[model samples]
Target: MLRHVVLFTWSDDADEERREQTLAALRRLPEEVGGMTSFAVGPDAGLREGNAHTALVADFPDVEAWRRYADDPVHLQIIADHVKPILAARSAVQYEV
Candidate 1:
């Protein structure tokens, strides 16, 4: 299996409503993309002061499957429409499990 992880820090002006809208868009991915074995997303619990504001973890059967999800139009649309505007910084990692 392949695991895809993402951490996001929102823009200074990002508000609760925008964050929730982004989360709602993220929640729709499993149904819209193929080859996702598992997926999860949540806000940071504030246990650590400098942690990213939000995070996402997704499991795929293989790198190709991960690629499909990465390139999916629906996913791109959501990122562009809902996420990009509010994003300050983002990082990701993909590894074999």
Candidate 2:
């Protein structure tokens, strides 16, 4: 399997509306994109300093499937139109599992 992990830190000035919009986009991803075998996304609990504001873990059957997900138009659109506007920083990793 391929495991993809993403960490996102929202801008300090991000408001509730922007956060909700981000969530809305994420909620649509599974249905809109293909090749996602498992997915989990949520805001951080803030149990530690220097943690990102949100995290996503998605598993795919293989690297090709993961790539399909990465290149999905809906995912790209949401990242560009909604997520990027309020993002302070982002990090990600993709690896075989």
Q: Per-residue lDDT for 25 in model 1?
A: 86
| Candidate 1 Cα errors over 4 Å, as ranges | none
- The candidate that achieves the highest lDDT relative to the unseen native structure: 1
How far is 85's C-alpha from truth in model 1 (Å)? 0.4
Residues 1-97, candidate 1, lDDT per residue (tens digit)?
A: 9999999999989989989999988988998775788999989899988899999999999998999889999899999998899999999999988
CA RMSD of each candidate after superposition? 0.8, 1.0
The residue pairs that clash in candidate 2, if any, are none
Candidate 2: tens digits of C-alpha lDDT, residues 15-96: 9778878977886888888588899888888799989988889999998989889998889998998899999999999998
Best-fitting candidate, measured by TM-score?
1
Kindly report which residue pairs in candidate 1 clash with one another: none
> Could you give me the TM-score of model 1 versus the true structure?
0.96
